[model samples]
Target chain A: MADSRAPDPTRRSERSRRAIYAAALALVTEVGYARTTVEAIAARAGVGKQTIYRWWPSKGAVLLEAFLDLADQAARAADGGAGLHGIPDTGDLAADLRLVLRATVDEMNDPAFDLPSRALAAEGIVDAELGAEFARKLLEPQLQLYVKRLRAGQEAGDVRRDIDVRVALELLVGPLAHRWLMRTLPLTHAYADAVADLALYGLAPRP
Target chain B: MADSRAPDPTRRSERSRRAIYAAALALVTEVGYARTTVEAIAARAGVGKQTIYRWWPSKGAVLLEAFLDLADQAARAADGGAGLHGIPDTGDLAADLRLVLRATVDEMNDPAFDLPSRALAAEGIVDAELGAEFARKLLEPQLQLYVKRLRAGQEAGDVRRDIDVRVALELLVGPLAHRWLMRTLPLTHAYADAVADLALYGLAPRP
Candidate 1:
């Protein structure tokens, strides 16, 4: 018979994993990506290096997973614990995109997401391998939600059938990313709405 | 009287300036922005460290000037020495934009611009001060060119007067920058044309 006071091995491991992720995110935010080493993360996490090595192959892998987890938490919070099912679709493509982009602006403004995400993004810019992995693992999945919605829109006769949904999505995403990354202008709800409207209706005057 | 065979002091100064620019770009590419120092740039440039101190206040300042010169060189080469007056105004907004964006795709493909620019961009992402400085100094000027062109477009009835040209330009620029920065896909001439087309025409089926 197990002792009532004994710490469960499964629960302990889960706590260690969460600790490792917190350490990774905190270290990356404080010192940036290149300087946030496995040794530092393990030390900060109060876990043995072997434990981290057993779960993740490299620091990049750890940070990627950490970021994914953070995004999941934010999504869950936003969707009332539903998780990131997909962007909401209410048949109006313009309204739906505006709603989503507004939420994106809110996320970009959040320091919890902003600082660590910037650190990872900074590294990904110079490190092509990491950048590609990030785009594939993190960005591409989120982008696919837009693709799914646009495909649905095509079926509903909202989006033009000839439009390449993939490239079309970039019109909205690119401006936001550019504004956010470059820090050229304030990333605001109004800006998001303008981007959605411009991308949907275009710069040319409606006939 | 000046020695007849001796190098002109002005010409010698110009050569030294060019050499400094080359070294700054090269060092940053080889060692990255964080590690690239003014002393190292001077050593690589074959000049005294005092010479660098006499010019730029910081390494960031030196890199900024160097990148500006590199962009000027690329532009002059493209326009056959006409210099970067502005984006070409052929009156046909679509064709003009297509031609310019295609050239941009070619520029992004150039390794000379690719390597060093990536280093600076990586640093900018996490370092908000540097990011803001680079944007104000380098990016905003280039963007202003688009603002000018779009203003002309509005007058010619190619673009809507109500459209915010500042944000409108991002639809073309954001996608290219996102693709180039993230290396998400093969940025091609065809892709540039698609971005331009989708931007000019509303995504919704035209009535």
Candidate 2:
């Protein structure tokens, strides 16, 4: 596999792609999504508009790719040298969830991620096609990481067998999303821990 | 208290106000929040823009009031000869939550409520100040009812004493909100019941 790839043209193209992604994200965040144009992004990235058009069909497509790149960078940064996409399965589900959620708390609080995310999320809420595209491309993939972790727990006999992994993951994720979107309260380590505990043990007393 | 109220003019003003609210909701649903104007609403209602201004401060204010009225109507309709806003206790927290959530599913699915509400929600997502105001005035009050019910559960020992009522309510509300906002899957009675079960009992098997 390593010998099958040549680095010359690919490396140069990768650098250009990174610049374009950076420019797209910055422009959308700086100005609103409605105001962002292809020419503007190309100008910011020092690329021709034809180059952007050649790569992506529309401004939304550019923004979607930009978000995907941003999320990947965030995931790598968050891996903390583990290079894992999900909570570490240390044979302790609760502890693993807490560790991941604490990191998520930190991430959600980061200004670099939060501002542009909020702007994009706000626009997505109004635009159905955009929102659906975001879900398919960015949000669903991140959520699938949770689904994988939950399935692992289920197989390990930690999670209940009857539970739907998809919906069950929502119990773990939904509260945090709601808090972040609504700005109802501060998203903190304490809050994350509480959500994890509640999600694990539930509100009802164990029989 | 009932006998000391003002007479016919107050009643007439109330009617016009209701008409104006209806008009505003219809216009927003049809034209979307951005294109929706006070002039359009007034024209739709067969009233003057000055009349709308005399009573309300801005288009956001008008939309807010319109939503409040719509919610009241929904609540009254759902109440169905019962008291408004309290989830049925029946000494069963899970069942009560499921019942309330099912009603919410119905309300969310209702075309009359869904269209305008979605329009407003879409606009609110993009507009921070407006979103905050709407959440504070309309959404928060509705959520507080859940808080009160949950606190009652705590007092009755049905709910855990340690769980934050505010956050715990999100465990109940968040999944539903996520499903509605994202359209990730079908929102059904069975789904609502499952969420309540998971929220109350958690994903982990009982030890």
Candidate 3:
């Protein structure tokens, strides 16, 4: 009888998915990953538990997808439709990096992003399987963007050809990650720009 | 009573203190910070729960002090009586940094150090209060060693006078921390040496 009165299953599924993502993020932020449960998420999301289970194999998977969705939304908002894919290639590598880093500072500071991200990141630190999954699914792809840009710079002769782009990207991003995660200093655009300059120009006095 | 029979209370207290620290480290590594309890630590140390409470205010305090003790032990073991209290003043800053970083690689890879340290670090990532305590108690003092060395270099006309020693030190340590925490690559002595060289010499070709 319920199947006969079809009210667009696809739309209903999409709605359920968004609600589940919201519930999952909120639960993790509030109670932390150790305590957050799929059943609780489904209850808060006002959907059947089987609905969430159908889409994600576990709570970790749900959270990961939720974060990806949030990132996508934030990226779209920042670029007005450019989305969260790669840094813009504006010919000048330093300027491009600066722009991206500035955006990153904003994202990192955003409460919508900050609270849930910290919860997930903190969970990942302790759970080796979860941490590896998070790194593989989320972090590595974003890092690949830097690899692509650095390769472009290498071809352009802006970066040294002998340098490993992977390691070099760490120099660019590591300090910011350290500061952001540890809250050692203010995560500001100026700070990001300064990091970019130091990494690009080298700390030694130009001969 | 055994408490009244002590020839030297200070010596007896020191033994108990060491036992508590050892128990804290082992408990955290096995059960993690969330499940680790003062009672558990006390039990494992073969001391009363009241003994732990009398000496330390909280589980976090006990863990922090234990970690500090562990770090001091590792440093003393690495540098003998001199300890890792100061960066070596070998006149050549790059070479000195390389020597310390190589030791760090060894320390980070050691299981006795790595397991408990990772557990503590993982807890700190999510627990802001604990993380701040770790920085204030442990990481900052270690970092100041680099600051002193950089200041010496500035006096020697090797480092630029205008550079912020704190930020500059990050340029050297941040990349290494990133690689180690993320498990992106093998953290080797060669890798450490390269980080020191690149940070000191810069990525650009020397003119």
Against the hidden reference, what TM-scores do the models get?
Answer: 0.94, 0.89, 0.90
Where model 2 places Cα greater than 4 Å from the true spot, the runs are A1-11, A79-84, B1-8, B30-35, B78-84
In model 3 chain A, the worst 10-residue window by lDDT is A198-207
Give the interface RMSD of each candidate: 0.8, 1.7, 1.9
| Candidate 3 residue-wise lDDT, B1-207, digit = tens | 366764988988899999999999999999888889999999999899999999889998898889888887777766655576788998988788898887777777777777888888777777878888788888888889989998998898777776777787877778877766666678888888877777776655454
> Tens digits of per-residue lDDT for model 2 on B13-109?
8887988999999988887788899999898888888999999999988988899888877766655634345788888888899988888777777
Docking band of candidate 3 = acceptable
Kindly list the per-residue Cα lDDT of model 1 for residues B157-176, writing each as its tens digit. Answer: 99989989998999999999
Give the docking tier of candidate 2.
medium
Tens-digit lDDT track of model 2 for A1-207: 476756787787787788898888787778767788999989999889998998899888888988877766665566575433566889999998888777776667776666677778766665777778787777888788888889999999989999898898888778887777765677888888888889888988777
Order of candidate numbers by DockQ, starting with the best: 1, 2, 3
* DockQ scores of the candidates: 0.82, 0.50, 0.48
Q: Give the Cα error of residue A103 in candidate 1, in Å.
A: 1.4
At residue B3, candidate 1 shows an lDDT of 75
True contacts kept of 2: 0.55
Query: In terms of DockQ, which candidate is stronger, 1 or 2?
Result: 1
